[model samples]
Target chain A: MARARSEERRAEIVRAALEVIAERGYRGASLGAVAERVGLTQQGLLHYFPTKEALLVAVLEERDRWDTSGGRDRERWRLDLMESLVEYNAMRPGIVQTFSALLGESVTEDHPARAFFTERYTQVRENMAEVLRAEFGDELPGGLTPERVAPLLTAVMDGLQYQWLLDPDAVDMGASFRDFLALLREDSKRSA
Target chain B: MARARSEERRAEIVRAALEVIAERGYRGASLGAVAERVGLTQQGLLHYFPTKEALLVAVLEERDRWDTSGGRDRERWRLDLMESLVEYNAMRPGIVQTFSALLGESVTEDHPARAFFTERYTQVRENMAEVLRAEFGDELPGGLTPERVAPLLTAVMDGLQYQWLLDPDAVDMGASFRDFLALLREDSKRSA
Candidate 1:
């Protein structure tokens, strides 16, 4: 029971960090702000996370958990399921804002989150390749292998997020993704 | 002669800020660092750009100018010219990193660069629509209008930048952009 309570508190802290990050961005967010939101002193917060980077990692991991939940399998993801995920993201602006901010910063060579995003993209691209191969055999309709197009798939997903975050009213992220998917489907049809 | 020298100094300062931002990201970059690189005091740098935000805006504008130079017209961007631009970007990792960093932070509601990116994208999308219409007529093979597909074009370009930044060796940004263009060409063929 004590361990369960500790885990619960940790999760609460991660959520608070997400809120602070969404409002102020990762650069502007402070541990004190997150601590105050969760009613903990900075020292007490350190007992749980040990560092801001650790808290950021926790937040990213938790976000992945939310994304892959509901019977979704990352390795076996289909386009339709991915569309649903985009739709789900559209409902959560705060989480998306925090994620976009961190992803942008993570591109810097020395950013603490650099390795995390790099590794994530590597895995994400591989998983995308597997999904593509499962749907379309050795080659896509465009004559490019799944490996060749995986990065583009990941790029489109992320690019849509950036545009949507900047102008939620103007960008329909889910619809835009579906259109890309349609293009893929059309290519497949041509090759078939 | 004095006015010309002042303009030259301003351009020099913008270049310095770009380097600083590329090295440390926008949040970590300081006016003092940029000033030191250009052999100016912080106060001297402020004379050209009244604030850090102004400097950032100038950098962004300079980047756009470089992107659209050489008789290239924004209102009439061809896919081939876009390909050349991507190739040009591949040659300048530093400038790309600074732009990506600012673009990411600009997603925040209160960021100083937010308005600049928002306005820039709005114009970019319109320009992309014109590019598409010039190539394809009123509708694409996918049955979407140029206006509908413009955002995806911009998204793909920006998305490719993020992935390429993370792993330049793995991602051939120019080649991938060309592949997307091929898809567009193929789509047009089928509809024709």
Candidate 2:
């Protein structure tokens, strides 16, 4: 019961932090605002989070948990399912904004989240390569290696997000992503 | 001569602001830090830029001016020239980091730069579509309209930068972009 209660409190705190960050941005957000939402003093929050950077880290990890924690098979997403992931992302603009905001901010000089993103991209690339390998074998029909193609796949998904966020009505994130998948298939027709 | 001197002073301040934003990030960057870099008091800097938001807008516009302000025809870039542009971007990681960092942060709530990026992307997409229409004529071999494909081209460029920033050595930005260019051509081959 004690352990479960601690986990629940942590979850509430993370949710509160996300709301604050989403509203005020990471730089504008205050630990006080987050703690207040959860009915704790800033010092009390620090007992759990230790530092502002630690809280940021926890928020990012929790986001990934929400994204990938759907179930066991969710981790091993296929190409088609990846398209669905994009579709799912379209439904939740607020969450997508927060995640993208974090990603964009974290890439700069000595950001606490920079290392986290670097490692995540590394793993994401490796996982994408495996997905390509399983579906298309060692090399795609056009003789491109799975390792080589994985990054492009990742890039399109990310690139479309920026465009979609800027103008959702103009750029249908899911349809555009499907179009990209169609383009990917165009290569095989020529090679075959 | 006095007007020219003032223009030069503004340029110097903008450059200083860029360096500070790059090093400290946009969120962490301050007018005081920027002023200190260019030998101005905070009050003096305010005389030039009435607000921090104005300074940020000036920084972003300066970046575009550096990119597209090369002359008259620089604005009307062709598809092949775009490849050169990508190559050019690869050589300037600091500028790219600053631009991307701002872009990511601006996507969230009430960022001063959000409207700037939204308008810029609107212009960028329309420009990209024109480039595609000129080269491929309405649509490429895949029958995908230029309007539909414009976002993908932009997405590829933006997406690749994030990957390259995270791990430059592991991902050769230029070569991968060339590969994407090659993929774009694959569709034409089938249609032709």
Give the top-scoring candidate (lDDT).
1
Alpha carbon lDDT of each predicted model: 0.81, 0.79
In model 1, the fraction of reference contacts reproduced equals 0.57
Candidate 1 Cα lDDT to native: 0.81
TM-score to true structure, per model: 0.87, 0.86
Residues B13-112, model 1: lDDT tens digits? 9888887876776665678899999998999888898878778889989888777765264553787888999998888777787778778888876888
In candidate 1, what are the lDDT values of residues A1-192, reduced to their tens digit? Answer: 999999999999998887887677666567889999999999999999987877887898888876666525555377677899899989877777767777888886688887888888888888788888887777664567788778888888888888888888889999998887766676656556
At residue A163, what lDDT does model 2 achieve?
A: 79
- Note each model's CA RMSD in angstroms: 3.2, 3.3
Show the colliding residue pairs in model 2. none
CAPRI quality level assigned to candidate 1 from its DockQ score: medium
lDDT of 2 at A19: 86
DockQ of each: 0.55, 0.53
Reference A-B contact fraction recovered by candidate 2 = 0.58
